[model samples]
Target: MITDPQGTILALFLAFCRMGGCVMMLPGFGSGRLPPQIRLFAAVAISMGVLPVLWDLIYPKASAPGATYIALIFTETLIGIVYGLIARLYTLGMQFAGTILAMSIGFTAPGGHDVVEDATENALTNLLTLTGLLLLFMMDFHHVVLRALVESYAATPVGAVIDSQKMLITLTDTLRASTMIMLRLASPFLIYGLMFNVAIGLVNKLAPQIPIFFISTPFLIMGGLFLMYLSIAALVRQYADGFAPIFTSF
Candidate 1:
């Protein structure tokens, strides 16, 4: 049995790298505004917690650091990234739903505060996204996230090469399913918005002298906001229900 302190440290560092990569992209803690130092600190905490469990499984020899051991670190990091990306895909559901809702409510404009971290998204969309994230936290969804992380170790082991084709297929299926779900969630709003717009357009067309467009704007906004409030509870419940099954497959 290999018993070098240097090897142990190296092994730990490598394991930490994989864990850190995953934490960097994980939800809640991986928010764009979070400070890097804080993210790193969280990663460290997670690595420590996971180390004892993984050390024996990953660090077979404590002797000299061999080439295979070094390669395993890269594999572990890749596996971590894949796992994290799979979890992160769920956040897209919010984006999908929010975009549809905003479009239906006529708020999908090129508004300010349209950027979050590295991506461009309007304020309304961002608001809904933030709401979804906050709901996840309020519900202690992080526990579910942690459970998924632990489950990944069994589903997709460390030092194992990922099946890229399979992952791609899964990703595509996730995006499609999420978008469809969002469309379904926003269907009521979409129908309402469409009917309202058509009616308002007809009024404008019939009476060219009236300022129907300006008058209808506030009514539309008020109606949409009310509908959103009405739907909020059901929306949250649906998200929670849908999210639980996602981890089971991964």
Candidate 2:
């Protein structure tokens, strides 16, 4: 029953290399809040679960001697990173939109520790990013990603040479798509800010004696918050919906 233990261990390690690489940069699972130990074990567990299904595809390749096996280690890790980044880039778009939203709405409060990342971010930006990420978790985004990873073996079998050009193209495409979606989500606030500022500028010109800029600050913040309250649910819902098509297509 324990014959070829070395071969079996090699196969498992090969599987872990890919799974671990993917988990290393995955969105919710890869967040700074999660301990590295937890991520490591999760990747190992997932690799174990997937190994049986992929044994035929991986065992022969892993058991090979010499430099070819070493090459596979690098290629598999690179492929996993490419796949993980596809989802990671999309999630990062929420942060991008949040920053723009905060700036446009004049909600640039003092920075606070971000719940997702170590960096300091505006309160409104943090709120938006946290809400979006939480919604993605609630929607079980990781399940979708795991399913994609399982399916990926068929598209990219073990031992195949990694194509750096294709990986670059895929990454670029994901960036373009995510940027477009984020901009669309943030466009309303942009327009609102532009119109509000233009009106304020005219008011300042018309009534030069008044400190209109200072007086309008409260109104700008209030209006932006009110607008966000009215539309945030829809905005987040749309953002979540956009994720599926991207992941599925990728």
The pairs that clash in candidate 2 are none
Best by TM-score: 2
- Tell me the tens digit of each residue's lDDT in model 2 across 44-96: 99999999998899999877657988888888888788888998999899889
Q: Summarize candidate 1's per-residue lDDT along 93-117 as a digit string, tens digits.
A: 7877787788787774685553334
- Which ten residues in a row are the worst by lDDT in model 1? 108-117
Best model number under lDDT = 2
- Over 4 Å off in model 2, which ranges? none
Residue pairs clashing in model 1 are 2-62, 2-63
Q: How accurate is candidate 1 locally (lDDT)?
A: 0.73
